[model samples]
Target chain A: MTRNVSICAMAQIKNQPAIWQHRFQGMLMECFESIMEQTQVTFDMDTGLRNVVTCSDDVFDARTISDAAVTDVVGAHFRGEEKVAQDGISALGYAMACILSGHDDLILVMGHCKESQSESRNMCTNLSFDPFYSRPLGLDYLNAAAFQARAYMEETGLTDAHLADIVVRSRQNGAHTRHARENEQVTAKEVMASPLVADPIRQMHHYPVTDWAVGFLLCCEERAHEFTDNPVRLTGFGSCMDSYFLGDRDLTAHFALKKACARAYTMAGITDPEKELDLVELNDACAYQLPLWAEGIGITGKARGPKWMEAGGMDKHHVNLSGGMLNGNPLMLGGLARAAYGFTQLQGTAGINQVTGLQRALAHGTTGAAGQHHAVLILEK
Target chain B: MTEKTTAGLVADIFATMESRVIPEGVDGITANYGYIITGPGGGQWTVCVADGRVTVVEDLVTPDVTTTCANDDWIAITLGKLDGMTAFSSGKLKVTGDMGLLVAAAGFFEKYQPPLAEITVADIFATMESRVNPDGVQGITANCGYRITGDNGGEWTVCVADGKVTVLAGIKDPDVTTTCADTDWIAITLGKLDGMTAFSSGKLKVTGNLDILSTAARFFKKYSPPSAGPEEAPEELIVLKQVLSIPQTFATGPVMGHFLNALKEKRILANQCPECQRLQIPPREVCAECVVRCKEFVQIGPEGIISTPDVAYYASPDPLTGETRETPYCSCHFLLDGCKDHETMWHELKASDIPRAERGVRVRPVWNDTLTGSVTDIKYFEIIDD
Candidate 1:
């Protein structure tokens, strides 16, 4: 049997708009020390912490080889260190792979993104596109999501009122989530009145730009007891990427998301996700993506998003109880944020957002424009 | 091109109803929208939307809401040339039954696309006289000639004499003549392409009495392309755009510092690994191959043979300056004297020597007049003539 990996401890600084006072290295060091304190882990070559997986993006940091900036803080000096330039959750997945492969027993996964360090978050994301066809059109994550939002709404009859309800509920749930960006509670009316940044995507509908740093202590399942009494077993992990071009995709189809979720489900031996899973955390960068990704995960029937919302499926399924990504988490760290929340809920330390008998949880993360790439992780206590 | 009758225009609007329906606006709704156009070529029609589908009929059916308007006004509203509320307040359009439904119906369709009527250079010249501004030519008298080439191209002259303008076919004793491609001329006249930019870029050429052409912009009002919809205002946001930069200090270790210091005195240096006996140009503290520290330094040549040459055509900005590099410069690796196989030092080959850049070509470093202890001390490598 393949070795099982468990996240023994999770640590993060608070999510904020800028954190202008601290550099990204300073932000990461806090989480690194926190993880070390929480787990009492060490860089023991024989059995403890041999490799580190770091998550960051060069475009956001404005420096090439960004992981080099945080190598010393994460204890990667003169040691094995790898970087996942995608989402932070992928760093966790990579650490899991290293432990499972028997290369190392314990691995440190650290991720940081200072979105405030850049001039415009959209301008940095705009570089993700090819220069010839997409960049000239000024297609960024926001406007590209606008195109998807308009198209998804057309297919599912998702109204503007439905989107407003999502924004209002996210802020309400954000009040209960620790380390979540502290945004003022907004009513549905306020959300509806908010001006559009991109048509069909009101400024209130999308997550705000945020700066954050997170670290996790992941170890082999057999050795996990040494780190913490409460360990969240990461049973399954899967990711999928769709076509690069926006025109090549069916905006409402949720093609990449479905594939990602299916792979995770099969790996975790989850036969019925809607019936088996107790909690879900979706990487909803925008409001419409909540229901769209819900359907993609097979937690709700396809094209039944509007009906599902009307029937209170969001509450029934315990989705995004940590306020989700719409409550403001930085890009490239949304999945890691979801995983952090999942770890909290599993540890029974989620405060007000915790469920009574939370046995299984699904946390998702996405990258690229209009959900072009997706990653799903299944965690169990 | 034949003019479209009002009835045909109304029919075309209904024909495109299915393609333009916003599903969210009509979700779970069953409604019949009727139109009774009154004027020459006026007719009645009905659009039925039910069960998330839409269909159009020639005759009016029992309708939840009926809009009554002249055929021309209906066409104008559909084309977005006239606002529906402005027509309604002016007594040109009347709505009967279900006023609430009419308000909801406003969002049911996307902006309609009238068939494209391409604007040509000939059309721009033909409308120039009608579009002339009286204030612009109040005291100006000049004859401007155009020699438009390429497809749909022709010659024409516009004579502006003291607030009165007349256009004549072909050049006639022109004070200044502008020559350009037909497509470029149309783009310039329609304001899609700036005339000054086109002239500077050689897309447009002006000869004789250059001062007269300076007033050409004031000669006419803005031209509107036929059948073009109004440009929608961009979405508003209080977005903050800032340029954030950090000054950084890089500490070059003793090994790299030694290599750079030698460049100032017109010398080249490479560190040799004790274990592998291999040289590292622009030396690193540790040898990657043997994983050992190197303490030995050897003097190499300021002249070398090009091992590999890569000509870069795409321009990427320099990290330090944030300015794009001039393109088509050759990035090359040179095997300096006393070095063998992949120990080649990387630098740029001179632009003038780019054509001669090839394997085994003998080249020498061209040093800057003021030598700083930097890699740029040797500006670039140029091919040496034996």
Candidate 2:
């Protein structure tokens, strides 16, 4: 990479179902202040923070151009600001692009989502479908994922029991995480017996609805050292979009994720993902997605997710040390949370969730129904 | 021949076809035709002319040829003012099913006259795309939904792409959706009722992006609100009300379930983590400090000391249920027998204990006569002088 973008600082509040006493702006302000407090990066129109990138959705935030809603909190003092209405991880890719393009140097990336604000999160997701085909059929992310899960399970012969194991590990891992929603570990029996939400998928199979916000300060390599002593460079970024119609896609295939990872890895000069990367922080919105997405990103072999999930495999592999997506984190902000956790891991400030010392990490996030679009990033210490 | 609607125009074409002239240079053509005239005055009409007999009906009859266009264009085609070949040459008139049949159908009708222009609320929406003023939203695409109430009770979806607007009949996931009474909407559009007045009076409700809708107003040509008639305000208004019932259930995981169930036996249990020596009064799964699972369940105090107690002078209303509990109640946290300081469990203290509610005060759980496996099984904890 010509000019590597490094993360100066990162901060986030623990995932909460609702923070009714205060507004979302306050939550974002706290994250903003915390990041500034760590890096001491001030926003000066002359030579400091230049542009801001925000990850938000009109439907999710119940408003359009949602970045404009958080101006006072994030980058009102900057030279420019742009909002990406996709998943949070995608905004990181966009911010990196802006820096590489020589358009801006220091960029503040903030992402937030609150599932507690809406009556049902599914209602917001259902609207993402094309009104003609999918919306008429009442398709949402959960049911669409159920279709993918069923197909993926049928193809790999994965069962509901295997899903329980993933949830148990996710919850157990979440216990050690700083900002996890469901921290208590559960047995396979409890997870399997949990109420059936979308057949073959118990309630525990999906990510819990949470309210969270995260922020990161990024700058070029030279500018990075000025901000922080320990700076992790963002070497590669790739994002791709797939078919909008669920019928058009092969339910069992993570072609978009694979293609995105291929582009990102190629840029980072990565030959082997499993061997090269020290840790992987991925948005596993559901338990099924963890292994399926792991395979999608070329980490594990086909149908080998369960094997890699064996008691100590994740710790050995250094995956989702911040408990990953399923334990908590809102939908749009899931990827950003993953990136925040990854940044913390590389910075060696992950506290209890920190794994064995590492050098390289992959952060990933997906958007749209049934993972129609995927984004990947490679950060190095 | 003088009917004002597209249906009337089709009726006149069929009436002219009844006498039927194949033009001096044409031959007897056996074919069916369908016309989907657009705009506010538009509708579906079928024209079938076979062996000198002509039939026209107001329905979508899949025919040998179908021409979809605006109502005015169809009228112009019938009147021969807009050349049939020219309309087809341009994209203004779209022909599907069979191309040859359209020319044949054009020859099927004779000397028809175009009618006067008449527009309606429906016309504004149908021709919305044609009225786009691209300058409104430089380079943006957004969906805006319309839900009209009272008489014109129907839904419409409008998609504004780059500077053009396309309107359709039904709902679309929108950037901003607006709901308003039909009368108020018409009054606002036609320049009769003030948009702000309608909005303030609760007649217009908008969700999603409010700015998008404001920008969308400039996307189209200015709408002329209908002229208002003399009106008088009503002295009284009736409000409609209805009751709703929603059932909800919550999960109390294994740890909390054990704590609640043990209440029925008048026994209190707490879990102690091996990594952390401190025990929890109410058994929980993982210890926050150690991040380790705690399975060692030890019986906590039926009798314990009060770690903290807040005797409130006034009751705080439940925000959700909108109800208030009795005031001057002492809400206390107890450090159960097995649990140490800082591992206190919270519950309400008995009314009599409110006077002595303070730090270092000992309390004991008061069990109800009816043993139910729930939190309510134990009444308020009473102060015990030890």
Candidate 3:
């Protein structure tokens, strides 16, 4: 077996609806300074950090080279830096590969996004589609998720009430999670009463537009102790992208997610993920995804998401105890936030949401419309 | 060796004739195709299609159409390595009898696969050293590794140093390594699936020194399956062109309001940064350099000198109006009279003045008849000769 890569420290600013007062660079500097304070890491070429990986999107940032805007603030001056344009969790995966390849031992991973910066998040997502086909029809993430939600609901018998329950529980859990976006607790009745943004998807079901910045210091397992007493090893990482066209995909089948999970599980030597994983952090950008992704990851049988939700499978699996993405993380940073929370719980630093004996955890992130791309990361203590 | 004999390839092509027939494509078509392959390993065969059913005979008999080509060219055409028309026009392939039957016969069958023996991963690696292009690898020194998985897959390294190339089994100390499924690897090598497309969509994974690995494409000449000619598709690609647009509105904020309001009165205003004392044209709310508020405003340019001029030949559609502006337009940055150094404002010069547009040329704004608080309040800047 090759050497493992350990996340020595992770830091993040509070996720908010909008951080209009400060620029995105200022938001990222807080996380950078916090990671520096926590690990006391430096920019030494031979002994310390040499390479930096950042995750952000060009369309969301409205800048061609978005990473260039934060290179100075992230301390990437005259150093090797690469940007992962997908969800930030891929940065963790990329950093892991760098360490395992013996190219660089220590890496700084940073990601930031302010969904509020754009006039409309839907407009930004709409541009992600091809100009000739999908974009002209105005197919954005929300409407695309509605199509998936309707399909999953019809197949699994998940109802409006079940979606309400998911939303209410997310906020109730988020109340205890610091740095989580401040969402008012709502009753299941209130969630049901919320107006539909798209058919079968209510306004309250989707993650709110949020601003966030997070950083993690990663080092090889051999030198893990040099950075911190508590180190969370990234045992495995895998990502899979499905077809670009929504019509080409069976929306609720979890085609990409299943392949991604299978690859990660094999890498971690996990035969039965349901039996081995201590906790699972799913990037549920919407309420339906909570159960849909749960089924996708094999925590429950196919078409059994509704029954599993009623039976409290979410709590039993200890999934999204940090309120998941539903309580609000920006689009690009959803998985990174999940990984950050998983890192905290494994370190026993999760204040009220902490669970005992967390030895292994799964963090999943998704990108593109209707979950076209999925990444799964396995973290072990 | 798995080099297929032309006779065997022709027999296999006829063997799969019935199954490869498309009922819709062959509907209402009655024809017989006679193939004459000459030279060593050559043979003759006839394909009969009637009432949507296909049958094959050992020899050419009562044929409505006949195609005559060399054994090598016949094999090349079947494997999609050489264009049928190219060979026909070049007299490498000769056709007689009903020519229309050949045109209708094109869509009668599905694409042909040359069988596993025709191409394999092992064959690709074994032939790498011999396929090296001397001119392509000149002065290049790098170690490129491959980890091809699946039933026929194995690891191999290509060491190129001092203009010489060597292929080694198993991965050595590599500067870069490319990992892909054996099937995808073969497709990429055969030009079936694009390598960049495979890499982007995650079908192919590459690690370590991407810059070094990029040169690997040039290190080896194109791979041609044994008994197959150069790789090029027979059909021309179909292209669909379209123009897409969406309506959008931008908020100009208070600082922009201060500047655009002055434009209505035939004047130009720029804001001064209190901290840096730098002026921002079109008036930004904050000074980017000082990162402080710029509250002081000054009237700068109704006229200015061009600092940079770019004459554009390509016409991209305007986002606001969804119209393509005429070509030979000059987009320039102007250093206004009151502004110094890099505080230049960007705008387009009049189309007619494009020939004379140059840096240090004096220009003045041409206002629209009815001014609205927008960037287009000034239609364009015209060159002020002398």
**Candidate closest to the true structure, highest DockQ:** 3
Clashing pairs in 1: none
Return the candidate ranking by TM-score, descending.
Answer: 3, 1, 2
lDDT (10s digit) by residue, model 2, range A1-381: 567788888888889877654356656767887877888776666678868888777766676677776775674443577888888898899989888887778889988786777778887887787665677687999999999998888887778888888888888888887877855678999999899898777899988888888898889877887788998889998988999888999976788998999999999999899899899888888888888888888878876766766545566667777778999889988788888888878888888867666889999999988899999999888
Candidate 1, residues A1-381, lDDT tens digits: the string is: 688999999999999988865667668767987887889887767866778999999988888999986687787877899999987777887887888888888999999998887778888888899876797788999999999999889888999999999999999999999999999999899999999999999999999989899999999999999999999999888899999999999988888988888888998999999999999999999999999999999989988888898899999999999999999999999999999999999999999878988899999999999989999999999
The candidate with the higher lDDT, 2 or 3, is 3
**Native contacts conserved, per model:** 0.00, 0.00, 0.00
Candidate 3: regions farther than 4 A off: A136-138, B1-317, B322-386
Candidate 1 lDDT over residue span B9-58, tens digit each: 66778788889999997887788999998877678888898977788888
Per model, how many backbone clashes are there?
0, 3, 0
lDDT string, candidate 2, B1-386, tens digits:
23334455645554465455544413466677888888755778777666666677778776877888887777777665677667877988987765645544545555654344443557557757766777875687889999887866578899877666779887788888899877777778767887778878998999898988777667777653222111444455544332222221233456667777788888888888798678886665555444345778888788888898987643444556644566557788888776776888888899887888888888888988998877778788998776
Error of 3 at B51 (Å): 68
DockQ, every prediction: 0.01, 0.02, 0.03
Could you estimate the TM-score for every candidate? 0.53, 0.52, 0.56
Rank by DockQ, highest first: 3, 2, 1
